[model samples]
Target chain A: MIGGKGISIWFFIGSLLLLYGIIITIANVVEMVSPSVDKQPVLHELNFGVWWGILLLIIGSVYFFSFRPWKKK
Target chain B: MLGNLKPLLTPLMASSSSLLSLGWVDSLIIIIYFAFVLGIGYYLLRFTKTGEDFFMAGRDMTMWIAGLSFVAANLGSLELMGWAASAYQYGILATHWYWIGAIPAMLFLGIIMMPFYYISKTHSVPGYLKLRFGEGASMLSATSFGFMTVFMSGINMYSMAIVMKVVLGWDIHFSIWVSSITVLVYVVLGGLLSAIFNEVLQFMLIWLGALMIPIIGLIETGGWSGMVARIQQNFPGGDYTHLWRTMGSFQDNPMGIHWTGIVFGLGAIISFAYWTTDFLVVQRVLTAKDLRSAKMAPIIGAGFKMMVPFIVILPGLLGLAVVMPKLVPENMVSAANPHSYNEVLPLMLARYAGPGLLGLGVTALIAGFMSGMAGNVSAFATVWTYDIYRPIHVKLTKKEESDSYYVKIGRWCTVLGVLVSIGTAYMVQQFASIMDYVQALFSFFLAPLFGTVILGMLWKRATKAGGFWGLFAGMFSSVGMWAWVKLDPSALKIIALSEYAKDMAENMYRGLWCFLIVVIVTVVVSLFTEPKPEKELVGLVRGCTELPSEGHLPIWRRPIFWASIVLTVFIVLNILFW
Candidate 1:
């Protein structure tokens, strides 16, 4: 049991954010991988999708890993 | 008008669109969703053995569950559908409700107010007022809150029905009754616990259900910049993309609300009152097992809340840029009906999502209404039982009843609450601008309630007489102002700079004046009226109470730290959109 009040929840939320970022970044990569999508006029603007993902990832990772799940306080 | 995305409309933009086009798969998805909601309620019934279990979820809710439910209860048909419509009509400016209007105040509540609330062990917001200002204030807040909750529930019901009627061509009465009865069952059976649980579930579904619009719309438009370029090309000088630019002057903005009204009237007073004091959301936090969880709930909720505009508000902007222009002619005239934009959310759902996804999308809409209605009904029941009914019962009978007796009454109140909400939903059909009226209710109920509670909590000298009279004065002033504006447009013109300052029609300015009346009256009356003894006020008053130390937690995990991050994001978003 994580003893801290908000520790575990932060980890969970952070991980979710990181996961969201990874997924979107991965999707963009996949679309970019496709020659057809790349050739299309769309700039594949990852503006909000990528940036928000990165922000969430940072916030989520910092919290998620703040306390080692395996360590005892 | 969604220029580049026009091709994405394809089959969806076909002349005929209805629920039948959603197919059997969609219907099954919706059916399974409802069954799951009701099934959980019935399943949770045995756990609800006591009034505590029913009303406060036995006060054992964790930070995540409580936090998610806190945000979820705030979202509903109104947030999803109404704001989507507002986004359609008002543009990116509508995002104010999600960002500036919400984030700062929610952080304030989490950092400042939650300690007092959690420590008090109060069953409801009115119960808190009762401790500080005495029972008269309690009863007034309770009765007004009780009415507000039911009416709010009805508005949710009405909103969903209208969306369905416009989109799927369903019978409004059928939709309203269906949602009302479902909410009545789940809430009555499992009470607050069920409501909270469903709220969390509804929260996830809403995201899964609605995220497609911005996703598909963004992709089709080649991304945010592309969409912006298209919108600029299509609606040049329309004030659609810029957030603060239009707020320079009332006439500059499409919505016509100036920066002062948005900031002071809405961002401070209205937002703080709703996020901090409204029991419907506050009750969720109070149910947390401990103070830490309670404080964490709203902060976590603020995180989620900051993201909501991307889902709800963008659809509205997309509607204006894409769907509305496609659905109507370029020369189409504006009407008073917000539902015209309200349909934008549903259109986005229909346009992008299909088959199983469509079912999920539609279910998301239903979930929003049911979750919203259940939230209101459950809140009404708690306030009615603890604040209104129980006190009256004890006074009349000169006795305290069994926990079971009160529980029974709560259950009965739940039923009555649902019925009243359903009735209110029927009444809502008469109004053209439903969301405006719903927002107006805050001026009438919350402005005064907030006045009393904020004064009572912060200032120990706020006497019972002051609290009661302040509440009365605040509500009276608000209603009188509303009436004055309605009966005599000249009065509104006199108050505002221009006939078209757009401030006159806004509930924000009205709430501001009402809030000012509440504050002035509350302070004046508090000065004159005799205050209660200091001994009587302990934990209820700030500085008199000992707040728990959270120093052990690191800065990253601290509420203030997260609050700063959220505030930073808020500033960045405003600047980016400006």
Candidate 2:
């Protein structure tokens, strides 16, 4: 809704990021429990996916809620 | 000490082919990205009813949207991967392109040059030339700009396809066709608006996708100081860590460049010309909602532009510190040496990213490549329709055509441009690296165009004949110098002014020489030719134009205020890194 109305670009960005975050976070959680055979990087023990996913979810949620097209109306 | 740690780092490089495969989660992320972009275009289709809407995004983009898209359009994955590769090959010297090579010119465009472009109501850069310099200059620039832009789109397209092939083991032909068609569908549907929206999204994806490398990389290396220490121990006697200390002599640094070339050729001429004159980026700012937004767009872009090196350059530096069996140049790449310099970004992503993150990284790159191609094709469509086709049509018909007719032509031209780009993508496969190829193309067209443009906008004496001939002479001389070096490799010493100057230095010096040629020729020709009436030159030239003031806005609201802040930070970063 940046230029007078329609679905805001931020909403699109947030929705996609939120969706990807949920998927990534859940997948990483399951992987942490099962410890799959897939080769991991040097700091894989740090579980970067879970934290990075959480970060995306937080940022995306802020954007999505703040600029939600319905809210603008 | 660093040499002793090589064995431990080898396992972390993720050199095995099996590790590159994307799981279902990764595939889902990429699919989602594609769906959203296409949906954006479809949603915007109704808003794009007129020619102005198609070519200019209805001239309603906010500074935030326009500014982000401005930088994002130029931040194609080709450049991301290429510059990261450059950082590895040339060390911190590659950061110059992001900093001095871009920031100063962007600020100049925002604070000084943006007024003329905004106030004149021109549709494209070539449209501005047409207003000031008449048809000869406009046609020449429009043709060349259209040509190079399409070729660039093809290069971007091919580069992405090749990266997909190399990194994910995806089929190159399938990658090229799929990506090109997706871009085509969207651009044809919603035009520049679609491209700008996608570019904004791509900018975010690029950050989210690539930011992990620098973050996790610093963690592994302990920190910036630790990474610097490791690099020093690994490449002892190599001037890789210091930004300016090794810039004194051509032989002192890995890039084999002198400070004069970096300052005069790169920072002064090439960077200024590209940022100020290149329509692909300028068109973004041109879509700003108002005069203030137009002026503010590039300045905002410059701020974000400063941080780009983190994602592009740091990965290359990280690769150097940890990657085993040193990456070789393209010519040296084979079964025995599978890693080339250009593969640095993808290699680093594979090394650090697991299943879900891997998809995001790949999606980011795909977004970069598609947005780049879309930007070029969209720009090409506008220039081709407005500058080239419309002029010819009016000449034949002795009247203007309908807006819908022109819009129809723009859509068709987009399709044709994409087709031509696909052909050019195949042509690019024969080249070793397209970075130098693209740089050479920029020098030929943009460097000279900047000369004609800056003079036209500044000096009232610059006549139509002067602008046309100046542009002709500059382009001819650039191509002539390129041929001179090609026919006799020793001529590089004369052209670049040093035997130690490499391909990168050669590009900068060439841009500098061409710019000088255009200025000298324009000045000489204008002095002999009759000048245009000052009244007629209003809005097109500086002195004759009555520029609109920003009014009594607060100091924080002024463009100059932000520009100064950006400039101060720029100076500080150069000093800190130096």
In order of the candidates, what TM-score does chain B achieve? 0.92, 0.95
Screening candidate 1 with a backbone cut-off below 3 angstroms (N, C-alpha, C), the clashing residue pairs are A11-A64, A14-A60, B88-B316
Q: What is the C-alpha lDDT profile of model 1 across B1-578, one tens digit per residue? A: 33553443332221244522444445555656677778768866877878898898888888888999999998886678778877766779888888888998899888888888888889999999888878988888888889877877777677777667666666678788777888898888989988987888788768867887888788777777887787777677776777888787777777877898888877888888889989999999998878888888899999999999988988777666565344332245355322345467777776665334556677778888788888888899999999999889899999999898888999999999988877777777776576576657655787567767788788888888888888888888888877787789888765554577675335777777777888888889889878888878878888678787879998877777877888898899889998
Per-residue lDDT over B1-578 for candidate 2, one digit per residue giving the tens place of the 0 to 100 score: 43564553332222236326776677777878888899988888988989989999999999999999999999988889999999999898899999999999999999888999988999999999999999999999999999889987887788787777777777778788888999999999999999998999899999999999999999999999989988888788776666788989898888888999999999999998999999999999999999899999999999999999999999999988987778899899887768889888888988888768988998888988988899999999999999999999999999998999999999999999999999988988876476466647666888999999999999999999999999999999999999899899999999999878898899889999999999999999999999889988998899998877767889899999999999999999999989
lDDT of each: 0.75, 0.89
**Highest DockQ among the candidates is held by which one?**
2
What is the Cα-based lDDT of residue B531 in candidate 1?
83
Q: After superposition, how far is residue B417 of candidate 1 from its true place, in Å?
A: 0.9
Predicted complexes: DockQ each: 0.07, 0.69
Q: The CA-based lDDT of model 1 is what?
A: 0.75
TM-score for each model: 0.84, 0.95
Model 2 chain B poorest 10 in a row by lDDT: B10-19
